[model samples]
Target: MANVTFTSPRMQRDLTVYAVAGDTHTLLSVAKKNKVPLESDCENGECGSCLIQVSVLSGKAPVGMALTEKEKTVLRYAGKITQAQIDDAETNDRPPPWRLACQFIVRHEDILVTF
Candidate 1:
């Protein structure tokens, strides 16, 4: 299980919910199950509508999470992330903060999500 906290500035509210995650459970799925009010289109990595900034709250590692190839392309095209950041993540084994919610799988770690 992972604790997923979502904070929406537009709604002026935040919710903390528990998610039972397996290898297939993405953040978007958990959000939908808990009614976190995340706006998403396509429900896949093809569109960038579900882009979110993620932070590690308490985990085995402080790093955020790895970005998928589709996430890298969309976020880069939208200017949400830079190539330099991608390079850093690749070379340093670090995680990028920006991610497509649809593509990010929630592991057994607590995370904070902002959209």
Candidate 2:
């Protein structure tokens, strides 16, 4: 299991939930299930409204999670990530801090999500 903590000024307090590692569920689904108040539109990866900042909290290297092509385009257009960041993520397995919640798959590592 991995601990996913959601934090935002829109919420009264931080909320943390457990998620099964390697599950097909996206972070947006998890947020909906837990009522994390994460704003989203177009559940698909086409919209960038579900953008979030994810930070690994396990005090270790973050697990590599693949970014979908749609996610790359949307994030790039939003200026959330750069070409170099994308290249690094693709080549070095280093994910950029910004991600689309609808495309992010939780790995077996604790993480803090800020929206």
Candidate 3:
């Protein structure tokens, strides 16, 4: 059981921060729970189509931290990805490479996600 939450951005009402289990976890969980709009075409990391930004809580538990090699390749075609992002994933093994939302289970708190 994780704590899921969402915080609206300062000015934009539609632009909000979605927290799954209250942390950087899965978009599928939060999207499903809050009914956030999504178009999960492949549902796998193969398409980089469901890419969403998320911020992990400080000192948060390590949830889904590594992208499969295949996912990394998809990200290569994701367009406009920075080496910094790749480095970030290298360090944490989770994050940046965009996890396959359908592959991992939810387990995190206080993650700031934008929809």
Q: Write the per-residue lDDT of candidate 2 for residues 1-115, one digit (tens) a residue.
A: 8999999999999999999999999999999999889989898999899999999998998877788999999999999999999999999999999999999999999999999
Q: What's the best-to-worst order under TM-score?
A: 2, 1, 3
Candidate 2 residue pairs that clash: none
Superposed Cα deviation of residue 115, candidate 1 (Å): 0.7
Query: What ranges in model 2 sit over 4 Å off?
Result: none
Measured with C-alpha atoms, the lDDT of residue 93 in candidate 3 is: 57
Note the clash tally of each candidate.
Answer: 0, 0, 11
**TM-score for every candidate vs. truth?**
0.86, 0.98, 0.57
Question: Candidate 3: which stretches are off by over 4 Å?
Answer: 1-26, 57-64, 80-84, 91-94, 97-100, 103-105
Q: Which digits, one per residue and each the tens of the lDDT, describe model 3 over residues 15-72?
A: 3443444355456655656665554777766666555555555466555555666566
Decide which is better by TM-score, 2 or 3.
2
- Report the lDDT tens digits of candidate 1 across residue range 42-112: 98798999989888888466444577888899999999889989988888866778888899888777889
TM-score of 2: 0.98
Q: Give the lDDT of residue 24 in candidate 2.
A: 94
Q: List the residue pairs that clash in candidate 1.
A: none
